[model samples]
Target chain A: MTLRTESRFADPDAAYRLLVEAHRKIDPEHGPALDAALVLLLANHIGDPAVLADAIAVAVKVVSPQRQ
Target chain B: MFQFAYRRSPDQDRSSPPRHDVVVVGAGPVGLTLAIDLAQRGRRVLLLDDADRIGEGSRAICFSKRALEVWDRLGVAAPMLAKGVQWQVGKVFLRDEQVYRFDLLAEPGHKMPAFINLQQYYAEAFLVARAGELPGIDLRWKNKVTAVADRGGHVAVTIDTPDGPYELEASHLVACDGARSPIRAMLGAAFIGETFEDQFLIADVKMRAEFPTERWFWFDPPFHTGQSALLHKQPDDVWRIDLQLGRDADPEVERRPERVRPRIERMLGHGDFEFEWISLYRFQCRRMERFVHGRVIFAGDSAHQVSPFGARGANSGVEDAENLAWKLDLTLSGGNAAALLGSYDAERVQAADDNILNSTRATDFIAPHSEYERMLRNVALGLARGHEVGKRMVNAGRLSQPSLYASPLSTPDHDAWDAGPPPGAHLRDVPLGDGFLTDAFRAAGCRFTVLRDGAGPEVPGAAVIDAAASPLFAARYGTRPGDAYLLRPDGYVAGRFRAAAAGAIPAALHRARGAA
Candidate 1:
């Protein structure tokens, strides 16, 4: 399926799932979450709402206290 | 009223004080440093960070001789040194077998801190306390920057604060917001490079046993699936351990040592240790294609994200700040053309790539995917162990050496880009240059000041920064009568000259003012 377009989602898991999928596509290795967080943060600004929500969902899943 | 701004602007009313000479975007180590450098230079400066507190992560652990020199210039390298453990040697192991080692402080009889393991939080906190002491130096916390606009002659910044959005226009904006710099993105700067597909767990644990405060690398970090764990020391009995996670991994499973303990115990020696904090990390060997976009400039992670394998991520960002700080000080005040800032982009971007390559080489060595590649690494590791120099060379690879670059700002000396003591000679890892420097005494973190014999070279506007080069005295440059090299405020090779080379020193200083 094509990438979906969604904005900030109330459910973090949903938003982050979208993010993790995008990250998997962008970061095949999945080593540096900071980069993923960065991509997700920027994606939130520039990505489709669905994409941003997905990233956020995945980010919430990954980054804890996750203070950059 | 007029206390903050030591000097006022022409556009200012007779009744009003000036805003500031410059407004540093983030109060991380880089931003605090720039504020300190400019403030000490008698310029009005303001520093801001989104977070109220200093760094909290086990980020950038190893500091190069260049970084030590910058610290020396700032005059606090000693106190910070007191806070860190000095290291000159690194041990590399392939899976369960310990294989090779390398010493950045190869030759003896030099003053420089080879590579230091200190938390970024301590460094930033020290800088914060230092900045607080200086008059006209104001650091604002929780100042989340939203947008930046270059208004012809100057740049304007708008921040989303807890109260309301406030606007502050300055001569320039130094964005140290890190890899995902919103300011840089707003200005449409290009960050180029791909993300690596390795997930690692970084845990700062408190260990009871003696794990000799040196960096130990496990080829296939014998923990949690096919991953590796890195063990090194931080001040206060804290040890930094990195464990790679599987592709389809869950953070919950990796955060607690209970799940990861067996894996770590198998790799190192035991897992009976108090855990501090756990973080899951993913590194991208990506960098901003450009460092500066108009009136705004990027520093630290905002500029690039190198794999943490080689300690390049945070250290290189610090280098970005150190390199840009002096130039920003000179240029932000309208002394140099705005074009001076262009070199920040040109030179640092190269350094970023160098950092990526260094991290890539180290990461690939321990965590190769292909059988052929893995076999080749094993052969290299086995072969190197047989010879002393070979062993050191392999060790150097693990310590993140042999990574150097020639940026636009670097004045190619007759000996420029020649093989330095390593597998590579990129900007980030050089022994603070060829002075009589040696061992942990050789500084990889201070603003190295090499005082050559005869008529010393003159570095025009070269500020003799205050430095406390302690415990790492062996790394200081030019301990010998004839040898000498000075590090810039940030920690790249700033200037190198003979005793009589003083005549060329000022020109080099000008060259150091900005990138080529």
Candidate 2:
């Protein structure tokens, strides 16, 4: 099955706010650790390596300086 | 209190020693069980041991259900069960926070529990007591086999007794000596494998506390810093504690009461306990190239060894004895000796490899060898706090289970069955009449058994069990009223068929016995 990029969440803005609020009180040095933890958590939930790799590629393509 | 009587053997003349049908070396749990099983099968067995008494300290504490079943067949399970601690729940902790818990025996209605914790000495004492009751078993203490020579049709062994040294001959010799098997060394066999670098300190302490009967394991905790620790309950108000000591820790200093007491006090919050036994050991995963060498076969730690993390060491050895005993008995009864012994080597080597692989994985996870491994283990433990997937990743110990002997001896299934144990799998115990199916199988001398859904054709020389007696029979067999299963003497399925004739069961039994 293809990876869905459609809006599955009913309210995207509230979900995005909740995701950001989870890291509000973290120290700057621990930011990457928290991000790594969140990535692992979400990857485990997704449960498919192919979809995870595709998601990682798409994120890099959208945010990488060379791609831009 | 365990008491061991020093039974002396009649001195044999130095010129010509007596010959026996089977001579077993080492009177440990494995050797004793094999001797008892063989003698019960009407084989004259001579059991020899270097030590006059049973094992010292609680060397092997965890006995699995398969081991209990084997002991039950040998007529020693009742006393062991009465004196052992039965438990199933194991809790894994990450730095004082519970991460995951497991219940091994989730389903009920089985005779034996998932695991029992008893001292090795108690098991040996019970086995020795049972051995004394058997007629054909000759157990002699302070008799050590110093040399083993495999002649073409027989084996010649040299024994060193307190009186003097003597030479004896037997048709077959079995080595159940410990990891440092003198017979194995005498045979010029090499035990090849890896020896782990880390060491663990095992302390059996006697305390009158009300700790729950469960396995408590920690990756790292406030009481013990930067290492793993495990706590288990045994019989007689004793607790077994294992602390991981890194490669450089001095074993002599770590075993001192002064060093060990503070650690126990920190974990238990009191110093009102006495030390029963303390041992420091490094993990090793190794096995011999072959279990059967001509007429001399090896079992137990003499043949294979694995890390104690999985409780595979003694449990697998007992399985080896159970597997080898019947095959040896049949061979002595004029069956195809070569092919049957060859099957033993093939099956138990596979089991040893499985145990070693599982034990190595558990050891690597518990004591990570590299920084990258440590990082991954920590991440797994950290995520295990809430995530379900991470809980599955934490491997404290896999514990012990019976390994399916997938060998050519098992006849392939002819028809397609939906949901049941496949060929080469152990027979699943189900309620039959007032007892269990395994009880009936054992009552028939554990010979080749023919099980059918209902009575159709008579198979001579095989014990027939009608599956209609138990309600679970139909569900477990996954077949209709006419299907049949031919089982081996060791309770493994040899073959399965649909609408078999009278000769089919006998033919399958011959194939299972490794007849051409």
Model 1 lDDT tens row, A9-60: 4432233234334443644454356455766777767658776666455434
TM-score of each: 0.70, 0.88
Query: What is the lDDT for B41 in model 2?
Result: 84
Task: Give me the runs in candidate 1 sitting further than 4 Å from their true place.
Answer: A1-68, B1-18, B109-111, B221-226, B267-271, B369-371, B382-452, B456-516
The residue-by-residue lDDT of candidate 2 on B275-380, one tens digit each, is 9999899999999999999899999999999998889999999999989998999899898988899999999999999899778778878887655456656765
lDDT of 2 at B311: 94
Fnat for the candidates in order:
0.00, 0.00
- For all candidates, state DockQ relative to the true structure: 0.01, 0.04
Instruction: Label model 1 with its docking quality class.
Output: incorrect
lDDT, candidate 2, at B474: 77
Worst 10 residues of 1 chain B by lDDT: B1-10
Predicted structure with the largest TM-score when compared to the true one? 2
